[model samples]
Target: MTEQPDSVVNDPNNYKLSYRKLILPVSLISAGAISFAIPPMKELDLSAKIEVAHDRPGKTTLDNYTQYFPAVMVYGLNLAGIKGKHGFKDRTIIYATSQLISAAIVTPAKSLIAEERPDGSNKKSFPSGHAATAFSTAHFMYREYRDNNLLLSLSGYPFAAFTGVYRVLNNKHWMTDVVAGAGVGILSTELAYWLYPKMNTLISGKKKNNKSVVVPYYQSKGVGMSYLLVF
Candidate 1:
């Protein structure tokens, strides 16, 4: 006779949960709160003015680096086969929503603030878009991949920091702009995570426990050898 599964297996608390169970909605709400709170600080205006006055040229290189890093990171993740699995889809949703929100907020805010760029050019600078994008992407990576390994979580900080640095170095934005941008990125990621539950149910699926084995083969001096291992 076949053995019956234990009653504990069907217990409500015994089911496996996805990473989204805790992280997704919480992150979203947190991002929203931060985004709402950052815009009214008075010190940002003073710092922005100082940065614009001292701005110089030839710093476009930093801007270039900042602009391309997100694309590179996305490509790297894809190559690692991490995308489309293990919260990849959720991350993509976060990125897309963040991008949209950043663009919507930054463009209009820049125009309205009329805060001159660090380059001292026209008044189209307030909250650096590049910095915002970088932060958003970094936050997404952190939330999605941090659970996979600690190194991935650690890697996000440097990228987010550099994005702010590049904006300042390029003289395209002030310290205030970079700070606000960072806030925007973080907020966007959190919003995405929060909305994920209602937006898509695929993210809620649970994985089954399984095991795998691998075998290796080598050829030398016209002889072949093979080895097997189980995981």
Candidate 2:
């Protein structure tokens, strides 16, 4: 049988790719590459930016909060007894890995490409990190719930879509930037899914680590995380 993305394999020897699962990430990446390489598509990207700018829609900070809705839903649903594919630790690790991978890819690319934002804010705009984060979490939610509830699994996409669209609408990114970010995000999650089993094996094989407590602190305008090491 083909290995499912949500399958928990504690053995690194069982690590394998499921080609069927590659469709979404591959198609997105291909589309992104085409958008970057093809003249007509590049024109489309510019036209899209211009058209949206012309609309003069009032920019809102909604995207900031909504981008993480899918990931939040994953945990919320699981907590409410709508069990997902993996248990708490496994799902958390997978989600964290996906976020890490997406950040690692997007951060360096932003520095290297230095594409300016539509609003002329800065040059860290080749790929929309917000869109990338949205799609990565959306894909993570989908992978966890796809087999059981297809509709519910897909519910996160509209939010993800909105996040990407708003990145352009808010003049924070170009259409092509959002497209590339979506591709990168999905690819990140895909890689996380593939690597998680191997990672789990390695982690499980190790001796228990020292205990620690993570405390979340709310500050003036942001949240802070601190850890207490236990000997």
Candidate 3:
């Protein structure tokens, strides 16, 4: 048995159940939802304006690489001696889950809405997948290292924003599509963070004093010792 300290029990960071903490994230989602539903946004001419402003003949190849840059930066930061909120296992799980959630939401929305692309490529361009990927990575980086380095943590958003811009410039998605994708991406990461603790409990029990264990098993002529380490 272990005794919980008062500070640990009362820590708002642990539960994340406060209205103050949720206001910004919820606002992001609500803004996207309201904008997507409203008449002004429905008949918005911003996408055409952008295409007319920056329409070029060449294809945008850089955006494909930039979309995943934020996620790579998180690992780079960890390798460069910057500490994040969670360790390798938790971060991996959260990142993977966030991408999955983003995909699940984006895929069906595209199919159901069937919005036409800016360049008349296809009818499945309501929310930009590149935008979703970029923002998800941005939020993932933000959640991980915000405590250690605020500026570095914030660096991901610019890249994500650039990705959205490129998507519009490339005539792949509209401004509304990018905005909705950003909201979906942010919400996915937020949901992943909220679900992390529960996932940790289900995958492995709470941290223990002796976090390293080696157990041996033998089955007919086969024997092996499994080494388990938790940090």
Candidate 4:
């Protein structure tokens, strides 16, 4: 019997590219982009009708701050002796890079689109920043705790959804804006995951003919992965 070559089985370069892996993210981003061109998307009469019942009756006056709660919960859980998917260094880099990428996408798009807010506050309402932060944080929490505690991992989404809902209820953003923001947030985190592996290798000076399989470092002064920013 012939033994299979280790390089053939274990090489990252040998991995088969699959379109199935891209379906979810592509569909989500497409939904967001298509909303801009389609008539009925802007004509979301249902959302407009719901907006009339506005103002969170019992929620705190500082409701906008709720968007950051998911991220806080991630660290809180870590401090509470919960082991996440990554260690301190990997998680820190991945989470921070995710947020950084989100800011990059949201800020420039906001300036370019310049859509007016629901309450006529300003023209930076095309994509909801609160929703972006909420979802990105939620995804971070989800990725971290998912393998350890499914319930805790799933809990992040509701918090993120609530933030988006609050944004709409408070007349800060439109429904489409919320949807697009969600897409951006999710995509940002996914991109970070892809990039971190490569970035780690690059930063660690571990490129031998540029063919090394990227790995996360576990010790001080060790190299980590580079984050891929794929949309």
Candidate 5:
């Protein structure tokens, strides 16, 4: 963790829940929900769909892959020696947990809502799964690196936003669906962060005192990692 300068040090206060941070994501969810009832908001969704359908940009599979880029950046940055707030094991587990949570939320909504895709492809388009996963990973990246560099932390959002926009451009989801998915994704990631410590404790049972770091090396023959055990 010392490798990441300017990060918040582990402290009791850091564990205290901050409701203030909940405002934006919660508002996003509420707005998406309210869009269903409000005529103007509902019309806005329809207008967005029509516009995309009329002039859909070059349909690329970039959205499918870009969703995971932010999370990948975290690991790549770590390997490049710009560590974030957590170790590889910790960050990976948290991100995986976020994925599970986002899936849990998005999957059921897709089934129950039965909203057809803009392309009439299927009845699973109320919330975009890709958008949810994209934002979840983006938020994961943001949370890990926010204290280190604000710009670096925010770098994930462009990818997330692109994922959401392309879902519409590809006629995969409606505007409101993307917005709601983003809300769910952000909430899921936040929950994972809150739950990580408890989950780690439950699994470990005992505080881990041993210290070790794994360093990967590139060589002519083969690539391997060196495990350094520190007393």
Candidate 6:
């Protein structure tokens, strides 16, 4: 008779995993919060000016793409039925919360920084909302499906990168703003995941082992032989 597979047990310390996950985000937020609070270092402020000037061509080329990104993300999430899944439901909350927080942080920063845009046109140029939105969506996608497949995991990088590029192309934000926005987005998503256990019913549900088959193949005497086993 085939032996029964040994059952796996969930660790009582699983909640500890949540704390561990919180570390990087908390650190990032701490860094960003501190940096935003301090007066800009002289060299850093100069560098921002140079980068804005150098990035003009890119900003001009990619400006058109910025307007459509949010609409695209909304349509994609709605069509994908992401709202139906527990992980994604938590992700949506995180995304919205992060955006709101970033907006709050950014609005005042922009008003105070009064940093001129690359084109010298607008007053609010610090902390690109487009970059924040992009990073937030990329992070949300990463958290929602990171465990599902390798392909999904790889897809997030391009989206985030494109958003940053678009922001630069539009001359809507300085490089510093984009970096800070990215940090905010990633940190916010992590914070959401850390809080999920407290708010979502799915986290309280029974944990089950998901199984997949492993196959090994060998070639001998011009023929192929294979063996399959459950994992």
Give me the candidate number with maximum TM-score. 5
RMSD (Cα, Å) for all candidates, in order, is 14.4, 6.2, 9.9, 10.0, 7.9, 15.5
lDDT of 6 at 133: 52
lDDT of 5 by residue, 1-231 (tens): 334332222663543447875777787777777876898998898999878778887898888888878988987898789888887556655776777777777777777878878788788887777887788889989998899998999999999999988888988888988898888889888888887776555645443443444433221122345564533
Per-residue lDDT of candidate 3, residues 53-140 (tens digit): 6655566778877877888888666656565776555676677777777777777788798888877888877677778778889989
Best first by lDDT, ranked: 2, 5, 3, 4, 1, 6
lDDT of each: 0.53, 0.75, 0.69, 0.66, 0.75, 0.50
Among all windows of 10 consecutive residues in model 4, the one with the lowest summed lDDT is: 1-10
lDDT per residue for candidate 6 within 1-231, as digits (tens), equals 232222222332422336566565455445534545666743464576676567556335443353224424542654565331233233333444555555555566667876676667876666555555566556656665555544564466576777776665565555666666666666655655554455345433433222221211111111122332223
Off by over 4 Å in 2: 1-15, 34-36, 205-231
- 4 or 6, greater by lDDT: 4
Which residue window of length 10 is worst by lDDT in model 6? Answer: 214-223
Clashes per candidate, residues 3 or more apart or on different chains: 3, 0, 0, 16, 0, 2
- Return model 1's CA RMSD, one decimal: 14.4
Residue pairs whose backbone atoms clash in candidate 5: none
Could you give candidate 2's per-residue lDDT for residues 118-207 as a string of tens digits? 888888887778788888889989888998899999998899899899888988888888888888888888888888876666656443
TM-scores for candidates 1 onward, in order: 0.59, 0.81, 0.75, 0.74, 0.82, 0.57
* Residues 1-231, model 4: lDDT tens digits: 221111111244322334653466556656655767887877782467365455345534344666767777876676666767765455655776777777777777887988888777888886777777788889889877887898999788888888888777777778778888887777777777667666455555532223223222211122245443311
Name the candidate, 5 or 6, with the larger lDDT value.
Answer: 5
Compute the lDDT for candidate 1: 0.53
Give the Cα error of residue 34 in candidate 1, in Å: 14
- Point out the higher-scoring one by TM-score: 2 or 6: 2
